[model samples]
Target: MITTLRFTMLFAAALCAAGCGSDDEPAGSGTPGTGATTSSQASSGTGSGSSSGSGGSGSGGTGTGGDVTTTVVVNEISAKGSDWIELGNPGSAAADLGGFGLCDSDATGLCNTGDALRFPEGTELGPGEYLLVLGDQAVEVGPGPHTTCLAEGPSSCFYATWKVSASRGETVFLISPNDHVLNQLEYPMEAAADGQTWGRLPDLTGQGGVTAPTPGAANAAP
Candidate 1:
């Protein structure tokens, strides 16, 4: 009977030790928790979203291009008999000179008449091209009248019915189709010579000086 009691006690002690060991064990040792796995996946998704956002910002830095501007200028002038004014296109592309205006300025360098000679339709100056407008008296000389004036049969010259003042040395103005002034030149009475022509020295951007007549060509060296 005593032996039987001792065995029963021993069995009870073994059961207690097993229960204590199971209660003390760490949780989630055999399998992961559902909540913990979901949190880990959310963090990974957030990291991926941030990377994608950074990529989008990098691509947004590239933009569209710039603006382009163009201009034309008065290149040369001849106040002598059969006077002519030269228009130069020094830009990269052809310029439409249609509806452009030319006016003879009074002694005060102001256009009093509001009377401007407008270019005919379809008038275009090519890149680096020169256009010559000749006065009424000028048609008598220098390549002759526009009809048969060309040495090569066709000419690059146009007739201007108005004559430039040779003795007074008037101011010349170049006007756009919108009546905006593009360029102007004031010449003194002494600058007008009967045979010599006053023009820009080095083509488009030079000081005016007395040189030989160059009606349909570049200005001669001063």
Candidate 2:
């Protein structure tokens, strides 16, 4: 809130300064009103004219602005029993859900279409919290930082309906709120001699990566 207000104050000050400089002409000039006052002429008038106009304009506004420094982070992705994608908002301001989306890649291509879960008018994810979304539903619907266990049991299987079944070498993708791909997981469905089945790759942030298992056997968690 303070950040947005600060930006607004700065912007308003700028606009007022810009407007004041153009308001000191005569009644025929191209200044704000009908007046003709050149720089030399206005400079000669009482400095009070510029200062007064600036003060008036600056004090006339509401002094409010929208969110600033807002961002969304993909914290975790699970495609097992119930496909669930977890998002974290580590920003100072809340994010609007109006323009977010989720998409998948396949032969048919990006097949997600439904209502988008918009952060409610005052919905904010407070810093360091998670927004867990069930894949099958619209991207806009989810358990935000303030929600309990999806209103379902603690098994996490509530998301099972959204899981993407993997073949021996298939892949799964977790898209962003903008429908852009966030991360992908390519793993071996069948366990190897080491007993570890592939999981989501590590070290993925803004782009992409491969999902591989750590030093463990199949059924090991990522």
- How much is 48 displaced in model 1, in angstroms? 69
Local accuracy by lDDT, each model = 0.55, 0.35
Off by over 4 Å in 2: 1-70, 108-123, 137-162, 168-222
lDDT of 1: 0.55
Per-residue alpha-carbon lDDT of model 2 for 1-222, expressed as tens digits?
999999999998988876565455565645565655422101112121221111111111112221111344443444444455454444444544333333333333232323323333333344444455555653343523332344432223112123433443233333323333322333234322232233322221222222333211111242
Q: Which pairs of residues collide in model 1?
A: 82-138
TM-score (all chains, Cα) for each model: 0.57, 0.36
- What's the number of clashes in each of the models? 1, 18
Alpha-carbon shift of residue 82 in model 1 (angstroms): 1.9
Q: Per-residue lDDT for 1-222 in model 1, tens only?
A: 999999999999998887655566776556555443211001112111121111111111122211111245555667765567776665666766566666666445564335566677677777767777765534344332245332421275666555567676665555555554455555546684677776666665565667677665777864
Error of 1 at 1 (Å): 99
